[model samples]
Target: MAIATPQQDTPPSELAIEARGLVKRFDATLAVDGVDLTVRRGSITGILGPNGAGKTTTLRMLLGIIDPDEGTRRVLGHENPRDVARLIGYLPEERGLYPAMKAVEAIAFMGALRGLPLAEGRKRGRALLEDHGLGEAADRQIRHLSKGMAQIVQLLGTLVHDPQLVILDEPFSGLDAINQGKLEVLIRGLADRGVTVIFSTHVIAHAERLCESIAIIAGGRVPFAGRVDEARDRIPAQVRLETSAHDGPWRAALPDTARQVGQFWFFPLPETGVEPLLRALIDGEAGIQSLSIERAGLHDAFVAIAGEAAAARLVTSDAGEEG
Candidate 1:
């Protein structure tokens, strides 16, 4: 077998971030192995995976926090991200803020590191604080602020230099529901303003609610990518129905895409036929009460793919423990 080589004429750059066969090894273990990612311009791209699923490792290698052993990756049109640091906003899973420094000071310091002018950095910091509802805490020391506030500051510092792409790693961790909602809104607002936002999270709802597109990664590889609906479409559209009687004439009148799960009826339609289904149910006196098609969401897809990998990992871990 012959391996394909890169063509002499490479294609023009159109992606915000492009990675091919990315591999990163920590000692003997491969944290990330042969992952490909393409984040489009002016869109929110989500990296979805379970814990230790190599999402963070992939992010780090792409951002130049670490280098891949044998792969190609480009961030904001640069193969070497370090040179493009000023044009990228990176909110790492771990906070990079100075615990003893004031909120505004820490934010300004990060901006300065990105080579922004001191006055400009300070001005950006102030705007960020005001925008994220942290205006009052701008003067307070980072050590004195709550975790959520500090997180907001970290995010602010990332965006202070007005980077073209924002990479947020687990940005919603340890936050209350309200804070998560605010963060999701902020992320969507960034995408709306034409910033290519790439973020990773264990929280499925955040990814589902905020991102227009997503990549589902597990065991150091992407099982799915592209539009969220495209990925969801890979799984059948399952509409669940609850009826009064265990048996009904509606069963015979079921849509071509219908199936049964115990007493519940599931319809996997190309499109919704809720009205017809409901009418049939009512005619048959099946006492149908509820219908839902939103079940075939990212969560269901993630589970369908990654859940097996996770279960296998658990079984291996248990075997090792016994051994």
Candidate 2:
């Protein structure tokens, strides 16, 4: 409930997390392969991947919840992540709350696990509920609260200890559109207050909207990691042109990669530029009805980096999920 103001004294280049060559295996199945990641202090980073892409395993390794079979990691300057556990908060994909526990009690319980005093945790829990418009539900049992309310309570619990770094796994899994938006605002607010955040999600849109940087993983291997803009730059911009004339001399100006669909023509923007193409269209009387250029989105970049098959799997997996 007490959010820290953005710190002017913190260095811009400080690293919050650094991991390299992380590997984890479960029985004969390799859950994570040699992976490297870096997170800047006070930044929101997303581990973007489809279902079964080793996202959870990777997060667990970084959090010291599960030891890596190989590689090294440092969290908030400590070589052993667990050494700084008290400074970190984690919300696992699996949600758990005692049905009989009051909302405030549930939050206080979580904070107590991280070493907060019971009374202090209770005070903060009630304040958090009141701050987030759930003050009326503070005294209600968890079982009596709606699913969305319970989730918000758990999220507040994650922050009750005022952790410097927060790691969330599929935090948006079961929320509806409005709740999802609220979560996005909450995450942004955390980053604004200088709390480092790293979250994993199969959905690309959330990562695109919330993360300045992201790591794209598929089949336990990272295909890309860096700024979201860098990932989008992997592919060229696309051009969509609609013409009144189906056949004309301007057709010669179109790239060989262009494809026709109904009244629309689509292709990657030419290397030279759109000016030459526009001139050709106008001079040759191609009767251009409409033209637009669009940069590749994170979704298109995902398809480019992870391949169409993996992208298809991501779409199918997301479709089956309630959120």
Candidate 3:
């Protein structure tokens, strides 16, 4: 195991996951070339990437499921994960509960593996199921629950020990919308208790709303990582506006900051620009029935900083030729 930090003298309120230049290789191919990430002690950190972008590989290394070929990682400030896993919980991409086992028993077993007492683990397991709205499902066999219910069971299993840091990889795959919302609330609640939370998901919009910080992995590397709002500002916020009128003078009458959206003219104004823009729009009768300000986001920033063509190069790269 490689440790980025030798010791944890700092307050435990610091970062939960600190990785620098993490790399993993299988055979001649580099599954994860280089990536740096951090999960703050009480915040939800999101890792965004498409299906073959090495998100899972990076996560596996971070969780100590597999050692990286090169680079350093620390979870809950412990380099030796067997010791740290006592406080660091991981929910793998695949649901690992045994379908033949009762929900309560499966959760208890998972917790006991982390060194929790069996009776305490079972008690906590039942309570967690109730907290997650599945109190009645505790005695039911895993295979008898609905897909969504099973997911909740697995999640409760992940939390039975009340670990301080939780890492979830694609934990929202089969849930319906309502279940997704519940999960979001649960994640936020965990963070509220000062549990550093990190998860990978392709559901960009939902993650965008919940995660204040995000890391974008593209082609085995991190192309973007920062505050979501600041990341958005990096993308060019220019849009060409379109209008139904074939030839409208509103383009010229608009403020100097205006750019084009489609046929309509778009303009970025000062903090005071709102009133003047509306005034100008109404005055010129731009026939502007619709007006929207386009802002950059994780989506636009991903496409801009790392262009689609750049991702294509990585996709066609020999690294994942077999995937």
Candidate 4:
């Protein structure tokens, strides 16, 4: 299927999705707090948050699956989402495919519902399957395919219509590293063709690797939104050092906040260069085994801005899932 691209004279609003002060309530609980988000055209943006941080709720409101209690949203420049629903493709977190249907049939069926002709959908579906290394499974029933294969088929179904904007909710929730890598490549291909991609993922590394911009949602609100580098800048750089001398004048020169992890010392990089510290160690005859300066990653920034508690919870959940 051909991807859609912006026209030379396309309107000045080069945005795929925009929402301001969005809020949602479910009975007695507030599911989504006031949140503002912007997704640029022809770029991949990530919505990152913990399990119940309202990522799905925010997407639902933007997709017209549900209305926000307070705030406004525009998708593809349409104030009303339904007006542009057909121009967007969405893959929900939940897997929903008929077990009895052949893989190609299921993909084409979904496309047909979105106004894609069955014949054309089938042709594209076969091509998509072949391109994704699933050509042999095209005739197999959903029940007989591996979980990863089924997932790929569903994603192909989402793309069968060649939507201008694609929304994926927790697209990597359950997949091995190889399949996850494949999905990332697929997402990049879509953006390269001028298609906008907005995906929600709790895995910080995924956003750090794939997103040009991201919205960091926590506790049902977005606390940060901007370039990926901006998020990483929220925290200072870090340093790790190892030495033969455990205690000496060199040790005294180290910051009081320095922490020891096994045989290594870890701490935030000092405002000054390592020259002074190195000189101190040399003067005191402290043998430097190793040293490394590291920049803050998305996880570090998330912890600094969203608080250790939330970061800990997210990390724990991620570990459990991966295990």
Candidate 5:
């Protein structure tokens, strides 16, 4: 199989995927409300939201698997997704593989379905298996492989065509830490090769680490869409202090943003250094146990944008699934 080539003829537009006021309805329930998203060519972007937050629906619409009731979309520079279907690769959240099929055979079959000849597909599949550290398992049946192996095989099948754009839905749902890390590396490799990647994940950490930009959807609507740094900037820095003196004159030195959290007092650090506060606390004879400043992360940004309840729900759900 020929290596999937980077898009040689660049689209006049810089975007790989763009949607305007995309809306999808399931019966009377609006799965995706009016949402706008744009993924730049060769950039890795993430669609982040909790379960049932319309991420899957939005992806489907963008891929033309499902049409939106309202709005418009263009994929890979084509007005219609089918026009460039061969240029796109998709890995759905639901995992499936032919249990009786050999790993190499399975991957090759997928490539063949996407227009690659069986012989070439098989050749490429073998090489890919070796590259992915599954060379010994190439001839083994899918049913004999571990869940992680099967998952990687399925994902590789999605990549067989060497698509210009890869859209993955909850790609990290069931993988353990090691396999998850491997997948992250694979995603970055794709981006390094100039492939546009749009992945939807409930896990924000994956997006934080892998994406250049993100579209944050909540309640079926996108509340934020921009670079990761922009999102992080939406929330202020945090300061955590553990002090033996919980009250008195030391309290006066504390910023108005300060709040007690068990034995620690948490607050948003002002733009100025904490030196003044430290001096004030010491002058007031306050016994400081520990003090640390933390830069705001995606999780903190998400909470600030989507509210604590929604963020907490996603964290709880992710923990349960991982456990």
Candidate 6:
């Protein structure tokens, strides 16, 4: 189906979701603590963290799937998110589909739960399937489809109701590279149509590529939240230098933080700038074979903000559904 593009009547700066000091606990364990997040209307925002970082818990609290032990949230102007649940679409990390149901029926059923009439839902579902290259699979049973195809069906269901705000938890978890790329495109398309998209993922690359703003969570606490550029700015740019002389007085010009890896020297650009270092290298007769200043990327920023230990868990399997 050609998703209807909502009129862009809302200001870009208008808040779609505002969550303050959200806290959730299970037994004696704190899953989410003191998370404050904001999403601008018509923007793609990401909740980024490693496995077991409470990303899912925070999202659930925001959606009113589970009440926060403390704090408050406003979703699409409703102080209680449940009051506006019909306008929000959520795809949980744990995906499910009825084995006996046809792909189209599954999508329609999901839409019906969100208030779309079954007949209308089925019509939209078929159109969506055809639009997404799943037309041939529309009549196939969920049990017969490949894992990737089934996941696509669930994703299509998430949008069948054309929700104004969409929340996805680790939407990329099990997909291969090809499907992951396709999903990314779909997400961008939603934002283009003026839908507010908020997704949680441990993958920094996805956030770096798709999210205008991000919240970095770790150990049940949010360490950073804002525009991607602002998060990257938390760390200084890095300098990668390769000199003809591997060792010389020129090395003295390099900061104490500099480390030699292979033939390259890596360090944060000194506060005084690279001019002084370049001059010292030239005067000291250290042949400057190559020099490059690299801006800190999302991965670097994540490591800096969440600590190396937390960053190490990014690519690991999620600890539980709440991760």
Ranking by TM-score: 2, 6, 4, 5, 1, 3
Q: Tell me, by TM-score, which candidate is best.
A: 2
Poorest lDDT segment (10 consecutive residues) of candidate 2: 1-10
Q: Candidate order by lDDT, highest to lowest?
A: 2, 6, 4, 5, 1, 3
Q: Against the true structure, what is each candidate's TM-score?
A: 0.83, 0.93, 0.82, 0.89, 0.88, 0.90
Report the lDDT of model 3 for residue 182: 88
Which candidate would rank higher by TM-score, 1 or 2? 2
> What would the per-residue lDDT of candidate 1 be over residues 64-163, giving only the tens digit for each residue?
9888987988887888988888888998887767789999888888888788887888888988899888899988999999888898888888888888
- Output the TM-score of candidate 2: 0.93
Which tens-of-lDDT digit does each residue in 1-323 have in candidate 3?
A: 22222223435448777788888988988889878776778888888777778889998998888998887777777875556878978889888788899999989998998888989989999889888778898899998999888888888888889898898998777777678778889998998898888998766665677897888777788877776776678855544445555445545555576655456665554355456656765566566666666776666676776677543433221123211
Which has the better lDDT: candidate 3, or candidate 4? 4
Number of clashing pairs per prediction, in order: 0, 0, 18, 0, 1, 2
Q: Tell me the deviation in Å of residue 197 in model 1.
A: 0.7
Please give the lDDT score at residue 16 for candidate 1.
81
Greater TM-score among 1 and 5 belongs to 5
Candidate 4 CA-lDDT value: 0.85
Candidate 1 local lDDT, residue 231:
63
Per-residue lDDT of model 4, residues 1-323, tens digit only: 11112222334398887788898999999988888877789999998888898999999999999999899888999999988877889999998999999999999998997889999999999999999999999999999988888988999999999999999999887777778889999999999999999999888878888999888888888888888888897877788899999787788767899999999998887777778777877898779899898999888888887888778756423333341
Tell me which of candidates 1 and 5 scores higher on lDDT: 5
Residue pairs in clash, model 5: 1-120
C-alpha-based local distance difference test score of model 2: 0.88
How many residue pairs clash in model 1?
0
For all candidates in order, the CA lDDT equals 0.77, 0.88, 0.75, 0.85, 0.85, 0.87
